[model samples]
Target: MKSILLCFGLLFISFLSPDISAVRADYRSASENQEEAEKLYTELASVSDTDEVLLLGYKGATATLMAKYAKGVSAKTAYFKEGKGLIEQAISTAPDNIELRYIRLSVQENAPKIVRYHKEIDEDKQFILDHYPNLKDGETKKYIKGFVSQSASFSEAEKQLF
Candidate 1:
């Protein structure tokens, strides 16, 4: 009877272990980082091109950091969307900027596992094909093909631009 009581006490203690506290702390940090990233994104959006190119670079870096944290939290879908939007906006303001394209591709490559928006992907592919179609086929292209084939949205879009 004493052994049984001791065993129950140990089990209860294990259930209230420190690991849970550490996990909660990690979650809180991720949440705080996400909020900071959102703020930086908002500030970047409001800034004009008259600002130094370095400012845009800083914003992109901040966005990427936020995305990394979001991915860690398994909130990747939201992170990718937000990161993509920020990069796209920056690119539009600085069309000749090569760094923007690299940042955009980085976000795309790291995008979390989710239902692919086939229409949007297809439009991007077609645009590339129309201009740089001659580019050699690669693994990324193959993966995208598979995604489009599997995605229901791809079928529903039926050539419509996303």
Candidate 2:
């Protein structure tokens, strides 16, 4: 119990860095790897009270990834529901955050058809593309472009524009 408490304490402390680049990389990595998902979930699950939109977005994305790996239907639904709620809250809090929109687009693009999370795929894709050139952050623009280039949601011509 002591060790568990200490580990939990340490994990919460790790979130204080608010490193956007780390979270961005983790978002991409955790989306494709179960081990990365577990690590990200562990790191963010204890820090929900944070007002940081990027942190919250990554937390939500990690939750959805964990939902895919969860053992049962109920568990999967619970994870998805919680994660979706966090994501929606974060977007509602920061509608202009391109990173948050990209997070949503990724989730929606890959979400099960039955879950109906794809409503904003086009909107987000267009928003990212239209704003790509004007975005001040080169790394973020590159990340968004990279994802868009590979996204099935975008047309062949649209993908090439990036």
Assess the local accuracy of residue 78 in candidate 1 as a C-alpha lDDT between 0 and 100.
60
How far is 133's C-alpha from truth in model 2 (Å)?
Answer: 1.7
User: lDDT score, residue 1, model 2?
Assistant: 100
Please give the range of 10 consecutive residues that has the lowest summed lDDT in model 1.
Answer: 19-28
The C-alpha stretches of model 1 lying farther than 4 A from their native spots are 1-50, 57-61, 71-78, 113-162
lDDT for model 1, please: 0.46
lDDT of 2 at 34: 90
Cα-based TM-score, every candidate: 0.35, 0.86
Let me know the TM-score candidate 2 reaches against the reference structure: 0.86
TM-score result, candidate 1: 0.35
Which 10-residue window in model 2 sums to the lowest lDDT? 43-52
Best by lDDT: 2
